[model samples]
Target: MISKYPQLFEFIEALLPDNFSQSQVGMSGATTNPRLVAQAVLESPHQWSDYLTSLSGRLTEAERARRLYDQVIVEGARQLHPLWISSRRTLGWLSAQIEGGEDMDERALVARGLQLARLAPNVMIKVPGSEQGYRAIEQLVAKGCSINNTFCFSVSQAAACLKAIHDGRLRAQLQGVSTERARYVISFMIGRLGAQEEFARQASQRRLCLTAADRRWAEILVYQAIQALLRRRPTPARLLLCSLKIDTDVQGREHCWHLQRTGADCTLYTLTPQIIEFLIRSQQQGRPVVPANGWVQVPKRVLNRLMAIPYFNQAYFEGDLAPADFASQPAFITASNDAREGTQRLSAFVQQTGDGAARPVIPPASDAPMEHWS
Candidate 1:
């Protein structure tokens, strides 16, 4: 498949394990979120039993959850550190996401990001793509921290983050701080974008004839437009495509639409283990046809029908949304809420664990040279 569909290899595989050895399978990087962490905690409670027991009982459930989240990311990064060093920091990055919720302010995000950065050099902190998130991203990057702008759905969000990253890199350079190892990425939740119902509602109101094909191409057009926009200027941040979903054609052949359509693009794709399995199993049928150009040309009729919808219009155009409009998008809101729920569930689960094994208390994270903010 690597020889046939080389584009599939250009991914920063998601869902990291404590002992990550999938690098041999063409995984260059990994990412995790509250949902992924919660899944991990549930899947391998025994692997973390001793570590969880070491956490102080005095800590709140929320605090314990955060600690567990960070520990998992740190362990993954540590395991990948050898590969990172061997590759001279070109690969083997693990993205550790901070707490996600509407209530996460800039100050708290920056503080959490700083803590995560100090845990591992190869860790890239994942920040939300809201207005405050962009501010935190800029501040953290200026302090020599790697960043991954996540929960992003529109071109405007990606553009804002690119500017933030560029400005932050400039500030870091001026401060004589080295960001050579600090890679940056902007994630496009393509699957979530497609799943949003706002487009259909808007089309209904406008009396536009929307079809399944139009719905499918909505995010693909947006992603291609963002890719073109990003390439128009040089910036340190790379565009990452995530939240990929699979679909079956009329002939009943399974396909990951985004990968089949634009997997050849020179951008990072973050695939979960399930998606990876789908790709591996898909090989049994034979090599799927992938387009030579990652930038897909939307059909004229499909574009005409989709342009009638306000959500589609906003998503397809770069300037339709301001930085302030990012959080209100249905896709962002749903994803953020899901993350919050995941975190809450994880905290409750941690509190309910019956493991009574007492172990040596894990010492608190050592303080790095603290940056005094006036």
Candidate 2:
């Protein structure tokens, strides 16, 4: 099915090799985070027990944790090394995230991004889309590092990141640095945008009863608007749509609207395990998929009601939210908080279990595979 759409690239959002292999038959790459790293360790302790034990007792807990985090990320990169080489670095990118915070300093983000990029050639640093984050992204890209701009939900944020990527690429070119393999992606968190709490609260406050379908259009429209914006000014970056939801219509037919309503060339979809399996099942059931050129026309009535919610309005329009206001947005706040918690959990696991030569006992294997930390 994916072959029918040459422009649509699928990446599995996972780390461990088994899941990577199972879901990656047609996947171009994978993504990792502190949370996913920790989950990977917890699920398959044997994979990291030796490395954990090898960490010198002289190192502090935080130092050990950081090393362990990098180790996991590097391992993930190694897992996809074959694909990276096979694709000539055009595919098989593993997005590794730095410590996330809305107010994180640009210098620190850039430093961490450089450190992650040094781990592997295909490690795409996951930078935030905050005000400072834009600077960090530019500097990293200028240094010839591939970047995956995360936590982006609005048109303004996407535009800002796109410009930053372009400037960075231009700077790299001017400096005679090779950026032939340095790819840039701006992620639009579709599910997070639609499921943000503030959107629901605002809708209720306005006495508007929005159905699931109505809420789904919020991110879809924003994505389309961003697509239109990108088409006007082509750049070296592609849009990666993540955090997508699978919904059922009134007729009980299942659909992942992000794929159903998807358009544009050079668009990437980073699918969770559930979404990948759902697609496989849907394909087996012979469910019809919309073509890559398909467009969804959002009704004016639905659009008007959606615009009534300031959160939706801010996300749907390009100039509604400034870069300075990005950190204050509900979607940004939620994603940042979630990322912080994920990092904390991984850190806690390292601190609590890093004592002495006592090998942490691996838990009994479960039927289910690990899910994303978010």
Candidate 3:
């Protein structure tokens, strides 16, 4: 099956939320460039059909499948933001169907995504976070489209998403497309979210810490995005949370807490069916959603401090996390993750300051170093 559609499969694989995902994998190839994207769209009719045929040897056109999806309620709601990516696992048949023509897979998929955009204000057309996808995402945004900047692994991808939103909007406005409806998001997968497992592990070896602060880098982008949206506010482009893989020991609340603190009307979470079900399961299991005062507030100052926490630091949660867990990941084994043992190396940094755990408690100050403002 993999060999049958190597390019398509790889393209889709990059889209799927994974245990370990990288931005490089997300933005690779036709997924990034515009010309490449147009080519994929033109060819999707046939390739999409081929992909579907591979699945059952008798699937209908992509349009039919999408129409069937219309009433399904698929994975909405939890997916606060809509994604517009072409996936091998899910949307792989796009290429073949597009190539097939009159069969109407390409038009159907694009139209369907566009049509569905109306239903959800937070629609985010997820491309492979690549050139082709990025191009498409940019275009969609100009068409008053919303985007889910998929395939993000590193800060670079985030930066790229921001630029694409701007470029896509400019192109649309220059061409007079009334891109006022255009919007975009920078989706950074949360759990199992690190670029590599080695990153998580190396932080452990270095006694580097992990904190909501580490994840806060995204907040800065989000805040900046919020500001940009306010100034230009092209359909309110935003920063979103996607690919949320949970770490049982971490006990963090990615969105619930974030929404509370940031009150970020612009953000949303695109949780997969699996992730949605998992969160449901966790909630049913009697896990507390918010610990203090029954709710968590996400003030900008808090977010700012949280963002200051550098990446790959495991020391932040060394006390919270078992060393074995860190040792098991590739980053830990390779000892190559660039973990930042926060400026405040004191153990006191643990337990407080953006600890995302459901019921996180700050450690006694006497036990650790005082958290610094710088």
Q: Pick the candidate with the highest TM-score.
A: 2
The best-first sequence of candidates by lDDT reads 2, 1, 3
Candidates in order, TM-scores: namely 0.86, 0.87, 0.39
Candidate 2 weakest ten by summed lDDT = 365-374
Predicted candidate 2 versus true structure: per-residue lDDT over 13-131, tens digit per residue:
23223444333345678776655666677676656666767888898877887888888888878877877787677767789988763557999999888989999887899998899
Taking the tens digit of each residue's C-alpha lDDT, what string does model 3 give over 1-374? 23433444543354333411123232211111122222222333343333333444244434333332221222231132222232221111011011111122333435644665554443334443433444455666667665555434444444555666788778878887876444445654443344354444545665656455444434334334433443453434555554344333354633333323432344444434344344344444555333122223346654444334444322222222232232333322222121112111111111221132212223333221110000
- Tell me how many clashing residue pairs each candidate has: 0, 0, 68
Model 1: ten consecutive residues of lowest lDDT:
365-374
Q: lDDT by residue for model 1 over 249-354, one digit each (tens)?
A: 7998787767777754577777665566566566545664343464566789888888778898777888798778889999999899877866875676666653
**After superposing candidate 3, which stretches have Cα over 4 Å from the reference?**
1-124, 131-136, 139-145, 204-235, 245-265, 272-374
Model 2, TM vs. native: 0.87
